[model samples]
Target: MTGNESRVAIVTGGSRGIGRAVAERLAADGQSVVIVYAGNEAEAGKAVAAIEAAGGNAAAVRADVADETAVRAAFDLAEQRYGGVDVVVNAAGVMPLAPIAELDLDELDRVHRTNIRGTFVVDQQAARRIRPGGAIINFSTSVTRLNLPTYAAYAASKAAVEAISPILAKELRGRDITVNAVAPGPTATALFLDGKDEATVERMSKMNPMERLGRPEDIAEVVSSLAGPARWINGQTIYVNGGAA
Candidate 1:
């Protein structure tokens, strides 16, 4: 509740890729946005500028998703600037590919810290502060179902994320707030395409029934539905992977 203004949204990792798309789409939908990024402040600023250019209100804040205090400050900024938050998209995540046997413990910890712990931190803040009728969207990955090689630890962490989404929805019962996870399949983001060769990308793309990599906008559209006008669709993980999983 604005008590009457446009609802505010906090999109973590909003500086680039899918997160950037989510921020833009939500702002375009008429909500004031806080684009939270762990780094790449320049990209974050650009995301804010893009929203402003589109006649939407947005601000960028820097915060490590796993850091509770910094996340709280980001929420504080949203409240101060836009009145109160009504949506939170926890899209901040890290993926370092390795099989379980050879996986670096440090890398696993980092991924888990940002993926599992980060979701928990952001959800905690949203659960505490979001106005009634709000939505909390967390990002998981289709790899959990795909069982792809070299994604063991990454999948494991996101599996934890998937496991918690519905639990939080129940916890927020009677609050009229919805909690859900969006598990995207292989998408054409820098994070996904950076290391692979074109053939590899092609193979992954064809894995989907659609026979193409999911576009950032495609995923953003799903987020828009959840963040804005999809109140009845709560506590479920809507896999946006084109049935690859």
Candidate 2:
């Protein structure tokens, strides 16, 4: 937190869910936030407005993190707007569930491209451009550890991310930057609840020690802490999953 008040942060998939919450929280903590969304201009705009109304600085940028060119441009936008980028939260991802034998190869490929490749693209940019003392926070899911049925493909994608992050941290050793991942449990986001029955949802919630679904804000708090004064936390996959794993 020793940086200028105008420090810039780029949050992918910032239009909704945990990404939106992270963007708003970072803005509230005095960073100029760049909200990156894939296909929802309106949701992104609303996120910006919410930050602005809360007396925090933010702007919405349209980009698919899985696309290298788009992600490069998003980083460029942040640097141009605030002089330098200080933090990057790779919250953009997809979760399509199916048993191994029943899983569509197309669906598996899509998840891998977005979750695994997208994380690499963003981390590469952050490594090269982010200021010293900056943070690179990636997203993973608790399902990696939970080993839930129908989560094989999705979990595999995140498991790749979990494996890569620590190496990135070591690679950036001299830079004083921290690279980490946050693995959230079953959260009550639109994506997580979609197609699930009430009984199923409640049962999933009960799996956690907290005995309830996670809120987007709950995950945001972890991101905010890592991105700010808590610089000592590096190369760790912090599970903010209510001990569900």
Candidate 3:
């Protein structure tokens, strides 16, 4: 592949869910992928194997997205293995539901450590090291807009993500790097459906005009577009939730 066509990417939390889909999509789009996971080395290996089986270039790296040193090593692996980083999708995050009245501070801390601090750590690296024309995509939630009752802490963390995306984009003025965030609604990922009952899930499905839960591939499509040809879409928080909010 030509240099421009063979862009390389690092997808955090890429061992599962929307991140897994994003890794596969980017590889299918001709980018060499480095799938970054917080843990789950086996799953990370599986993701790499799937990409290789599909005749795409890929590797797996383990790093806590909130840990600066680990994140640096992950980026180092991407640069060392795939030549350089062209796209960084900060898809690593946590979502623990709780109302403000019954909030669990420890869980909130854990969520923020992974979701909010993680974005900051990862994006700081992307800002410092990503090549010109690179794209940095952070994951957000439609819950921020939907204002769902039990997602207070999760949405608050993502609100910080939304705040950082545009600010970083503006900071990268002449570098041609685009920093953006993708806010997804009730996507059919284990992370989203884990605690919900069938009735609750169905109710959420009805919130959007589409009357269905979003698929991981749906969100992957948006990431792919932003990472590749969607140059004009800089510093934007795109809601890919099918009119959920």
Candidate 4:
């Protein structure tokens, strides 16, 4: 990629929450963005519209991140639309909270299917397609370090993400592409706020020195850096938790 070239990006789970924020940030930074959603066409359209309204190039593709064929089509669209893909952010994930003893097998499978297999499928495509000087950013979670109760299934899936990212970075040795994971702590997204009561949210908020849940934009800032100028920061999992962990 040349200095004058505009980077192109594919962001999985780009319809809402942190993923949406990342997509917008990348677009704002002059990258052509393809917002990939599992089923939410409305949300995906909104994200694309928002980016376009801001004078950035964007499109939305509906695809299951765990489905290889669908993900490949998404990549093919990005390449066809924006010349070539320069970055991919695997922010697609599922979090089903349950204690180890009570966790249902079906729920475990659902969480792993999305969080583990989904990440792998997307990262696999990224490894095969992203151009040199590009990046693959996967999402992990601070729960892996917090050991929070009732997060066993969710935490385990993210632990796999943290493990695989560095190995993938090394595997792409001469490709000049960077691979890394961003682990966010208690962020204020629908995914994080859905089941918890006000009291639980309050407790988690204070756990961080910042005394509040992280904003999607805060995490996006780090992702923006990794996707662009932070070329040397490879094969690592960055904890964006305001020192919570």
Provide TM-scores for the models: 0.98, 0.97, 0.98, 0.98
User: Would you give me the overall lDDT of model 4?
Assistant: 0.95
Query: Which stretches in model 2 have alpha-carbon errors above 4 Å?
Result: 1-3
Candidate 3, residues 24-83, lDDT tens digits: the string is: 999999999999998899999999999999999999988889999999999999888878
lDDT of each: 0.94, 0.92, 0.94, 0.95
Residue-wise lDDT of candidate 1 within 100-147, one digit each (tens)?
A: 899999999999899999999999999999999899999999999999
Error of 4 at 48 (Å): 0.3
Poorly placed runs, candidate 4 (over 4 Å): none
lDDT per residue for candidate 2 within 175-208, as digits (tens), equals: 9999999999999898799888999999999998
Model 4 per-residue lDDT at 177:
95
Candidate 3: TM-score? Answer: 0.98
